[model samples]
Target chain A: MGCEEFELLLNGYIDGELKDPDLKRVEKHLAGCPPCQKLVRDYQRLKEVTAEMKFKNPPQEIWDSYWQRVFHRITRGVGWVFFLVGAVAVAGFAVYEFATDPAVEALQKLIVFAIFVGLGLLLISVIWERVKASKTDKYKEIER
Target chain B: MSLTEKEIVSKCQRGETEYYEQLVNKYKRSAYFYALGMVGSVEDALDLSQEAFIRAYRSIKRFKPQYQFKNWFFRILTNLCISHLRKKRRRRVEVSTEDKEGRTMPLPDDHFNPHLLLERKEIMRQLWKALSELGNKHREIILLRDFQGLSYKQIYEILEIPVGTVMSRLHQARSRLRVKMADFM
Candidate 1:
């Protein structure tokens, strides 16, 4: 194998991921190649140095309250969903009643109807864009 | 007997929400550190990691019992972190200063002499800086392999990439890191 080819496997060799024929081939190349030997040594040192590094620990209180925080968020999320659904339903019924009432002025009803129509169109446009974006998102497949 | 991770997940799926505490406690550190590595801020990391767990809990029903919880949970965390970074990029926010200030070096060992401790601390600081300077993809692979000590297979599972890709990416990442650390080495 050429040096370049061996270089690709160097990491595998260092990481002990190489197997059988590939491992033997790398071993043979490293036996006679001083530069490759130096590369391996340097990579090993890099790994060793990195292995010593650790993130400073956060306080114990973060751990103590982590679950409580998550639970609170989850419950709050559910509560918000219910609240929004109920609010929207009630508002929609109220608007419907006002728009249909005989005593309401025609111009006022038209204006309110137009406002809801505009809002609906805007919501549909946003949802459509989000769907299209999700479909076209290059990172979606890798991330999810 | 203590319940296994799979059992805990199964219970969670069945509506025993309290059982999820085990999972949160088990992975909180890893989740936080991984987010810290990605976003480079303590506050963001804490928020993102906690958000990941909440997201996981809400979607526990979709998680299959056969899959490793760690892999699935990390997939969520990774998405959140990457999205956070992208948004930060769009905003053109400068976070490097905060990153440096927020990170602390490992405490010096009492066993080591003062001079050696100082040298070690300097080396660690340089390494951390070089790591943070790496491109997003490179830094991610390094964080997964070196920082988290995840196996290549586990990384493939979490990243949803081929094992071959994982190996090549890790190699490329380490190579870049090596170049960045050349001055000190």
Candidate 2:
């Protein structure tokens, strides 16, 4: 292998990562090249030295508490949001289908009215909650 | 199919949520260390890794089993830590608490006497600093190849990069570290 190629692949060879053709070239080059041989040895020595450094694992509770707050609660809220949206979408589709169909006019009006009432109540609750939340935000965020 | 980690991951696609604890436990140490290596503190590493795991767990439902879970989760952890570090730097109110001895000493000298153990600790600290100073890509590749002991293909899979990229990055990372060995160890 050329000195350039050997330099490129030297680390891999030390890690026993060099494949056949490249490995062959490196071996052939090492047989004649003292600098290349020293380079390989030094690479190995450095790797061994650094390998002694150990990466530390984080403690267990931080992961547990952090995720629960960041993701668990967030997902739980988002899950409800998704369900509400899906329920609304499907209900709207059904009501439209029932109303627009000649054979289902009775079913359509009843379902549509039910959806309207339910949606109205839900919107009122959501609006009230949001207003309350905004009032809290005004209080809490104002401090910042 | 190379019977990729994707296969195991796909199995986790839904019911996978229940089994996620397995994946978390498996990656917990290495993932934590990788984060620790960058953030430079046990506390930050712990916080970051935990956060990383939670993010991974939250998105477990969307994880495709046909893909390798190793890379999938690691990418999330890597992204979370990097982003957290960026935001953290922005909120940089905490002036560094200087090591009390660092002010008067060179910081690496444990003693004037010949103690191999002290020397080894100094070496490890140096290496840790060297690894931390590497650019993010080099740091990730070294963690994957050396610390995590991933094969070339697996590193590529984890990185979602070409094999050539993995090889070159690995080379770059090692060369950078090799040059910094004195500073590191």
Candidate 3:
């Protein structure tokens, strides 16, 4: 194989992933080729430098409170779900009571009902826009 | 005797939530450091890593027993870091110089030579700066292999890519990194 072909396998060679014929071929090429050898040296140096670089360890308090923080987040998520459900239930019952009350005027009920319909439509519009944006966003694949 | 990871995961699957603490404790440093490497900020790394654990716990039932837990957790953590990077890209806000300077790795106490310590710190800082400038794929491949010390097969498992792709990607990433660190080298 020529240099270009061996170039592709050079990484595997350095990483010890090459075997048999491929390994022998790279070794033969490396013996004859200074550029390939230089490439190998460069990559090895990069690896060594990266190996020496480490992030500073976080404070002990972060570790001590780690599990507790996660647990609180989980419980808080559940709490928010319950709270939303209760809120919607209470609002629905109140709306039902107000609409059915004989003492309430027809115009007052109509105005209140219109306000809710407008709010619901606004919510749906916002959700639809977000879904559309998410689908077409150019940065979507960055997360992949 | 300490329970194996599989046994702990089994207990967690069986509704014993307390067993999960063991998994979290075991992998927290790995998770946090990986996040720190990707995001280049201490606070964001801590928050993102903890968020990944919360996400893993929420979906624990979907975890297949045949898979290694570290690889699975890393996949989740990596996705979070990538997504965080995506959002940061959208904002177009540069990481402040002070934040970067504040994150130097701790030098060993035995290295009492002041000049050597300063030189090492400078090299580390330059290395990190180069790393942060890389594209997401390049940066992540380097981190998974060089810094995290994951084997090619383990990297393939975590990345859900073929082994050939892993090697090629690592080579490309290192090449780009070499260009970035040309002055230091």
Candidate 4:
């Protein structure tokens, strides 16, 4: 096998993910190639050292209350959605009333109407752009 | 009989809200630790994992029975961490690892020491610092392969990539790490 082919198999060989024929080919290449042998050795040591490095355990209290926190978050998430929708609806109604009120100057009413329309369009455009990007982003599934 | 993960998900989609907790409890540790490895803080990890769970629960109906729920949930958690990292970097906020009294120490990128279990303290410290410095892709694959001990196939499932991609990515990650640790070697 070429050096490039052997290089591709090196990780799988070290990871024990290479199949028999490929593994034997890599082994034979390693026997004849000093550079490949050194690469494997280095990777093996790197793996051992990294394997030993572990994140410290957080306090047990975190785990104890984890579920509770998640529960509260889920509830609050629903609450926030309703709160936002209500807030937006109320604000939109207020703007609409101001725009239609007879006492308002024509320029002022037009400005309010323009601002509301601009914000609504902006929101839709942003959401549509996001949806389109998500469809095209190959890593979308990785992010779920 | 106890329900499988897929079965629990099916029940969750059917409006059995209580069954969702089973899914949470099943994968919470992995989810939290995975986020912790990515973000390098306990608080962010906790918050992001919980947030991911909420997102997953909200989208449970969209889940396919053919896929493993853990992988699906993990993907959500990973994306949340990536998004969190991007926002934190944009804001230039160090990870808040402060005491209640507000005393803080300066370190690289608000790093938390992961040398608690390693025999080689200096090496582990350098290893972690190098890991924190690596880009998101390299750091992620290193965490999955070396730290989490996930097989290539499992990494493939989580990454939604071909097995060859996993192998190549892992090799590149390890190579970058080796370069980063040249001083130690």
Clashing pairs in 2: B6-B67, B9-B65, B10-B65, B126-B184, B127-B184
For candidate 2, lDDT tens digit of each residue in B113-153? 22211244766656766776787788877877777777887
Candidate 3: list runs displaced more than 4 Å: A93-144, B93-120, B183-185
Instruction: Give the least accurate 10-residue stretch of model 3 chain B, judged by summed lDDT.
Output: B108-117
Q: After best superposition, candidate 2 residue B74: deviation in angstroms? A: 1.3
DockQ of each: 0.27, 0.14, 0.29, 0.31
Which candidate number has the best lDDT? Answer: 3
Chain A of candidate 1 gets a TM-score of 0.68
A best-first ranking of the candidates according to their TM-score comes to 3, 1, 4, 2
Q: Rank the candidates by DockQ, best first.
A: 4, 3, 1, 2
Residue pairs clashing, model 4: none
Q: List, residue by residue over A44-116, the lDDT tens digit for candidate 2.
A: 7666775566543234675565434544644676799999999999988996786777875677688878988
Where model 4 places Cα greater than 4 Å from the true spot, the runs are: A80-144, B93-108, B112-120, B183-185
- Shift of residue A42 alpha carbon in model 4, Å: 1.7
For all candidates listed, what's the TM-score of chain B alone?
0.83, 0.71, 0.84, 0.83
Q: lDDT per model, in order? A: 0.82, 0.67, 0.83, 0.82
| Candidate 2: segments with Cα more than 4 A from true spot | A55-144, B1-11, B88-120, B183-185
Summarize candidate 3's per-residue lDDT along B1-185 as a digit string, tens digits.
Answer: 99999999989888788899999999999898888888877778889999999899889899999999999999999999999878765534332123466753332221112222123577676787788778889899999988898888889888899998998898789889888877766
